[model samples]
Target: MNNLTNVIKERLTKIGKDFNEKEYGFLNTDERLRTPVLITLGGSHAYGTNIETSDMDIRGISMNSADNILLGKDFEQVANEPTDTTIYSFDKMTSLLTNCNPNTIEILGVKPEHILYKSDIGEELIKNKDMFLSLRAVKSFGGYANAQLYRLQQKSLVALTPEQLNAHIVKTLNGMRDMLEMKHDMKGIQVHLKDGEIVVDINVNDYPAESIAGVLNVFNKTLNDYHKNSVRNEKAMNHGKISKHAMHLLRLYMMCEDILLKGEINTYREKEHDLLMDIRNGKYLGEDGRPNKEFFDIVKEYEVKVEYAKKHTYLPMEPDIEKINNFRKRMNLRMVEQITKRR
Candidate 1:
């Protein structure tokens, strides 16, 4: 345990609370439920963007217990909600890391002092973190940034102009087939936009029932999301939300650009603290409580750079799934070994 972690534990313990308090006995103190392998600093502290009043966030990964594995029950995560602490099961963590998830990917690259605890398994996980980096970072990080921007824009991702809406429909229609059949059958479905109307031509045959069901499911979900995103948030116009979310919007873009351009992860924005803090502190917000022109102009510049990096980056289209699966199997076997030893 590090001094910072000890300080936190001591502080909490003194106040009639502990990290493994009654309700959270499953934390480090329990063997039947979960056991954390790595716990690191998260949120503003990890990003070097914290103020004096910033909340503490502790994030970690836990190995699946014997009961979880053998009982075939799902054990995804345990959280200390009040403290913003979360320990994800190893399997869930692997799933997220495999997709180059923006939030979890940063875990492997936090400054050393920020790492509160790490076991041998955690060390190995970190060593192979590079295996998780891929072209997916562009989409994952960019999508997250867009989500933040949506809050600031008071709009949903599905907010589209007349032409954009038609284009979206065309794209969705083009994918309405099974993964294998989509490639060969996409040519059969031709969609065209004439003046403001959509014209579609379907000349397909022998559509599998399963694929038809899959398309219906996907289309239903997509339509629901579009309906939901069309409504704007009333509170997004507030200054606090605008500025804070704008800061994150730019941060996400920066993080994505870094992964694409540098091929390394550095979560702490030490050099950009001034710029990020200024944005968060409302320096870039206008008198009307909206993000100012300067803010959007800055964001636009980053957007262009991110797009360029996305196109030119050397990263592969996907992570090495086979290698990642092998590593996960080894970890699971080790966990079972430890459990057997206790037995």
Candidate 2:
């Protein structure tokens, strides 16, 4: 194991948060409503950005009983918060994948070594991951990055200047992309100074509505946060994790752009390690220890790239719903067959 990997594993044990499969006793229920299928490292560790202070997150999928599938009983997931473990039912997992949800989607692409356990069905699930790739990613990933950007903006130690406001709009525009095109036949939305006031000209038609709403939601929250003014600024002074949020904000854009542009999941972020670590370590922070324009400049670069990709992306307009349903049935049928043999 690498030194960093050892440190992370050792850190988990030191904090008394280390775990084994046996510790997930919910898996032992008589009905087998949540049988383990796959488990993998999550959060920073899975992304290869974990530091010594990073917390461990274990995420996975579990196969549900035949009755739960056929009869529609409610067995969604079990959350062991103290241990930071979350395992979703196979059905729940498939549903989430249909939307290309970032959190659950990444679980399907974790590095093999990071995957602690996998049954035959789990392997098959990974093999068919491409079925879930679709244009919905334009909304899913960009939305996540926008949410992160909003959080970073919220806890800023100062009020938003016109320039900073421009950055926010641009970053968010990147996240929403052509989705905003629906709003106004958006030729293109760009934040610029008209007499020292931030002005956005949106030109779009038939863009994605949900993604546009997500951008507006974030902007509203940020505007409200600005209203808090000095009180929020003071609180921001003590907030050291803003850098981490900033790093993730940029990283999400990178990941999403890759998904839209290259048609890949890229969970570990091996090639971008140095740049991501620099951001995480505050290389892009200004004297106030807040994310500076330099970081936003980089974010803008990725945003432009993602826009170009959105127009020419090779991914489908939606997931292969029929295929996804078939795979779920196949996995669940194997699950039912297991129960039959046991009987």
| Residue-pair clashes per candidate | 0, 10
- Candidate 2: deviation at residue 301, Å? 0.9
Task: Predict model 2's lDDT versus the native.
Answer: 0.74
* Collision pairs in model 2: 179-208, 181-204, 181-205, 182-207, 185-203, 185-204, 185-205, 186-203, 186-204, 187-203
List the lowest-lDDT window of 10 residues for candidate 2: 1-10
Per-residue lDDT of 122 in model 1? 92
RMSD of each: 5.9, 6.6
Q: What would the TM-scores of all predictions be?
A: 0.74, 0.77
Judged by whole-model lDDT over C-alpha atoms, candidate 1 comes out at: 0.72
Highest lDDT model number: 2
What do the candidate models score in CA lDDT, each in turn?
Answer: 0.72, 0.74
Query: In candidate 2, what are the lDDT values of residues 233-339, reduced to their tens digit?
Result: 65764667777888787777777877888888888899899999999888998887778888889988988988898999889898888889989888888988986
Off by over 4 Å in 1: 1-33, 70-72, 155-236
Report the lDDT tens digits of candidate 1 across residue range 1-343: 3343454465445534335344434454544224567878789888988877777787888888877767755478777787687778899999888877878989998987777678788999999888998987876776677667645554323334657765655444443332223223333545567777666555657866675455456556655654554564333353266777888898888888888888878898887789999998989876766677899899999999999998888889988999999999898888878878888
